[model samples]
Target: MFDPVSTPDVQALVYASFAQLRHCRYLLLRIQDPAAARRWLRQDAVMGLLKARGQLGRETAQDEALAVAFTHTGLLRLGLQEDADFPFPSAFREGMNQPDRARALADANVETWRWGDLPGEQRQDVHLLLAHFRRTPFDEQGPLSAPALQAGGLELVQSVPTCPAFIERNEDTKESRLFEPFGFRDGLTQPVLHSTAERSRRLQQRREIDREMADDSVVADGEFVLGLPNEYGDLSYAPDDARWPSAGASANAPPHFGSHGSYLVVRHIRQHVDRFEAFDAAHPPPREGAPSLTEQMVGRRKDGAPLVQQPMPPADLDGFRFRVNDAEGFQCPLGSHIRRANPRDTLGSDVRSGVANAKLHRLIRRGRVYAGECQQADHGACGHADGRRGCGKGLFFIALNADLDRQFEFVQQRWIAHPQFADLDNESDPLLGGRGEAAFSVQSPTAGTRTTGLPAFTELVGGGYFFLPGLAALRFLAETEPAPGPPAQ
Candidate 1:
């Protein structure tokens, strides 16, 4: 049974990606004045801006929703005292632009990023990220005007620009699904939080089954939220306030700061659609009966079906594993984007251990596309209508995890960016991997392995790591005074 009280503390975004709310805006902000920011945080209007898990399905504004997250700097600016004994992880504390971490993320040119500050670089410091969603397009006077942002003590550090959400509407069923800028289904395979309403809903709707199957989709709650058991059957580590008390220590110490909180990874990944299209057109399918170049790279068809043929139902597209179904990657390329992202049952010493180990590094992705046209009439492709050069469109990538090092970073460094993945050398992930001259090897049973030179398709523009705090922790930051200690430098 769900903990009615504690579960409510989780943010609504943790439960739902708000994909139905097509019109979305992401605001990157910097706190100018601590007192004014604290005052703004305490406001009833500001508090209501953030929604909780229990508040879902009952939201009065069915077309709109809002959520907020904070960087380590943002938390400090909000008067959160630095606790030496128990602190946030190094990745979250140091920020995402750390020179070493940036390299791991394949952000080769982070120095040229419009926003985000590197270590010792104080020019651009983004403290807060406020995201707003709506069904209808935002008018000329968008949700938050310049003056309104100023009034809230938030210096507008340029809106993280995003185009309208891409839609693929089925005329017969009147059902609409999301697509990325590259004209492929987005958010198909996501980690379902264990014992939540979403899991129950999926099971009830027959989207998934509740058996002792090999499906790695359903993961422990602690993988995405703190203070819960993870796939390893251990409670996730959280920042305990009791570890280091204030001068006048009392029995009533504040709750663990990270309890119910999750680490949020945000990346502004710009997709070069024109370049990708040009590349695809240039490289047609190597074999007569093989898939297209785009399909080879993405490891899925345009409608989001896996390349490998599985015996599962259409709703269970993610039910297949690499070792059991396509060990040789004949059906799906070994170095494909989805395979590298989640190499289910193929990375360890054996199939069973590999599947179990992969569970430890799972991430709950909540991303959306921005600024790309789609052709609903054509069931095959849905990209730029004009196919213009330098189309300013990409994905607003967002992922949540309780352990950053093990989940997001590991996938990025060890798999996506690792050129030697799956015993293949000189090739990273075809779609989201490192830029410059790269190669993709597609295994074939009859024909020899066809290797294709791949150009950089995606580039990381701006990104940062943030802490999506629980409602209780949000209130603590808003109302309580900083613990008596020297502020962190």
Candidate 2:
């Protein structure tokens, strides 16, 4: 029952490409007649157009498809609400204010983080990856077609302003940078796309039969992008008659579905690297033949593998190669920042059960690290360097899913902040866990383990939640706004 090549992994590859191609397009259409706008929503023509365009494969019209669909008003606007506890003392509303200060701040922040501490070889790899994800403007294509407004129909309104930071993280203001909120080198982990081959590979990796469930659950292609069917026998966001008053559904019926759309939560988190480093320096773990501060915090070397579990640290390798892998809290403390965030093998059955509760709740993370200065090769050796000044270091954490409450929030509030994890004294996330009123400490029990105390950090500047609508939704929105014309006569 498993076909490797044309499976979900391939679909994911195609879809990811599609998502990048589509980018963000916002639109503003003005209707000459109010009745026409209502009529447009009632018809199925707009929906049909979206379906047809989505069907086009990547190779054929990737560029054209993107050009035709995205707009300044429809796709580009991310509806973000300000968090109540943002720590910034000054209110800098516009992105362009005090150009020199913003640049200096961003540069200083980047310098302080010691991103340059990474070996030259590692730096090159990171730069290449960052460049690959960058987006370019649509210069090749001409302006898009303006919608015609018939009697009570729609026309183009004012052009929506472009927020360049939406696509790229802020490059100025060091203290308010985005990326690595937790301070680890690679703070975010991304999900692997499930293609048929990918599924087979996963099954083989877990040594599971094709039909039976594997160790790590395998998600079908539709569950993520198109929204798989749920146990309630209702599609997510389905506009059934009973559920939606607009569709004339019964009061008990489920709401109308927007299967193609997904919810995205984008947070602009600022990292207090200076404070974190200072704490590490002040509380130097009684080096009674203990593991170094870096090892104690991450449970691994810079290369990203288990150092405690491996007898011999891999030579010339950034990480260690473990002879054994243990999901239990022994090897890597359960509360270690990375373990708390992912818990891949630790939770086992509990994780599966959680997944079954709401299948559509799954989300994919696509994030980037922005730093103020390129880490110099010698930065990490002594650790006490003048903090860089800039507003361009931190994480641009983005989560995409169909249901916000079930997926993104569940992961953030439950697993990341859950206090009852096995073997850990408290519920502090190793990397980003400074929440409560006071600082807290957790003991990592291993050959060279040391107890470390983490402090509470605050989020100062950030944005809000946004709905990434489908192409059909954009056209519908374009045709609904009231038109500009001679004073009503």
C-alpha TM-score for every candidate? 0.88, 0.51
Q: What does candidate 2's lDDT look like per residue over 347-380, in tens digits?
A: 4355455435424344566544333343432112
On a 0 to 100 scale, what is the lDDT of residue 481 in model 1?
68
Residue runs of model 2 more than 4 Å from their true location after superposition: 1-188, 193-217, 221-223, 230-234, 239-257, 277-301, 306-324, 348-362, 370-391, 434-453, 456-460, 481-489
The candidate 2 region of ten consecutive residues with least summed lDDT is 123-132
Q: TM-score of model 2 relative to the true fold?
A: 0.51
What is model 2's C-alpha RMSD?
14.1
RMSDs, each prediction? Answer: 4.4, 14.1
- Across residues 1-489, which tens digit of lDDT does each residue of candidate 1 receive? 335355677788888877666567788898887667767777776677678887876753566677889998888877776567778899988778998788777777787776673433433768988888766665544335666668778898867544443654454674557777677777778887786666666666554442333246678888888877788888788765443344356443324777788889988888888788788788787688668878878999877889987756655666677887899989888988999999988878887688788889888888766554434322123334555321238888999999989999999888888878888867878887663237788887877464556677888777889989887778778777666676533
The CA lDDT at 388 in model 1 is 35
